[model samples]
Target: MRALIALGGNAMTGPDGSAAPEAQDVAVAAAMEHVADLVAAGVDVVLTHGNGPQVGNLLVKNELAASVVPPVPLDWCGAQTQATIGFLIMDSLERALAVRGVRRQVATVVTRTRVDSEDPGFSRPSKPIGRYLPENEAKVLVEHGESWERRGDKGWRRVVASPEPLEILDAPAIIELAKAGYVVVGAGGGGVPVVRDADGTLRGVEAVVDKDLAAT
Candidate 1:
C-alpha cells in the first residue's frame, strides 16, 4: 500500500538535538529509521513535515541580526524551513532504504498551498509562530506590524492567520514522484502560503499555513 506520511516537528527535536544543521541531519536519520520499517514491509511512503521549531529558529536569527540584514517574511521563512528539513529528510530516507536493500530514489519538492485572499484569518491573525517571547519583547514585534497572541499559560507568540489550504500547488510533481516509486517529501509547514490574483496568477503571501490542515 502507498502511504502519505505527515511527519511532525518532533523528529527534528530529538534527544540528540543541537541547533547545527549536521545535527538536524542526524535527527532526520533517526526519524527515517522508523519509516524504513514500513518501506521494508513493501509500503511506498511519502513524507510531509512540520517546521514549527525550525522556522522559529530562523526568526530568532532574523530578529538578532535585524540591523545587519533585512528580515525574512513569514512565507519566506516557511519555504526556507521546507527546503532545510526536506534536504535532511530526503538524504536520511535514501540511507534508510539502502540499509534495507531497497533501492529507491527520494525527492523533496518545495510546495505552495493556495488560500483565499479574503480569508478572515488575515485580519484576525491568531496563529502562534516563532519563539514564544515575554510580553515586552512581543510589543517590539507588534510595533513593526507583527502581533502576539496568548499561547496557553506560557507566554505570547507571534501569530499569523492560518487559513485553510485550498490546494497544493505542487500536486503534479508529488503525484509523479510517487507514481515513479520515489519517496516524495513535500508540503512542509503546510506549504508557503500563496494567494491567487484576480488575473489568476499566484503570489506568495506573508503567512504560514498549518501543516495538518494542508494534509487534510
Candidate 2:
C-alpha cells in the first residue's frame, strides 16, 4: 500500500537543540532508519514534513539578509524550508534504500496549499516565531499583539492560530507523481498556505497552516 507520511518537526531536530546542517543530517538519518522498515516491506511511502523550527531559522536568515536584500516573505520562507528539510529526508531515505540494494525513486516537490483569504488568522497573528520567553517578556510580546503560551520550564512561547488546511493546491500533481512510483515529498510547512484571489489566481497567505491537520 502507498502511504503519505507527515514527519514532525521534532523528528528532524537534534538532541543538542541545534538544527545546524550537520545536526539535521544526523536527525534525518535517524528518521530514515525507521522509514527504511516500511520500504523494506515494499510499501511505497511519500513524505511530508513540518518546518516549525526550520521556518523560524529562515526568518532569522531573512532578518540577517534584510540589510543586503529585500527580506523574503513568510510564504517564500516556508517554501524554502520545505525544500531544505524535504531533501534532507528524501536523500537520506533513498541512500538507505540503495545501501540495502533496493531501487526506489524519491522526489521532493515544493507544494502549495490553498486557504481562505478571509481566514481570521490574518487579524490574530497568533503563530509564534523565534525562541521562548519568560512571563514578562511574553507580556511584552502580547502587548505587541502576539500570542504566547507556556512551554514547560522553558517559559512561554508564541502560539499562532495554525488554521485548518482547506485543500492541497497540488494534490493532483502529488497523486500523479506517487502513481508513477516515486516516493514524493510534498506539502511541507502545510504547503505554503495560499489563498484565492478575485481573479481566481492563487496567492500565498501570511498565516501558517498546521501540517498534520493538512496531511489528515
Q: What is the C-alpha lDDT of each candidate?
A: 0.84, 0.79
The best candidate by lDDT is 1
Mind giving the per-residue lDDT tens digits that candidate 2 earns over 1-216?
A: 988777887778889667788888999999898887898788988888888878888766654454466666677888889889878887899999888888887888899888877777765667777676678856654564445688789988766655668989888998898899888989987889888899989887567888888887
What TM-score does model 1 achieve against the real structure?
0.88
RMSD of each: 2.5, 4.2
Per-residue CA lDDT of model 1 for 1-216, tens digit only, reads 988888777668756545567667777888899998898898989899998878878989876665566677888899999998888887888888898998988899999999999999988887676777777766666666666786877888887888888999898999998999888999998999999999989998878787898987
For model 2, what is the error of residue 41's alpha carbon versus the real structure, in angstroms, after optimal superposition? 1.1
Model 2 segments more than 4 A misplaced: 132-161
lDDT of 1 at 112: 94
Residue runs of model 1 more than 4 Å from their true location after superposition: 16-22, 132-145, 148-156
C-alpha lDDT of residue 35 in model 1: 91
TM-scores for all candidates: the values are 0.88, 0.84
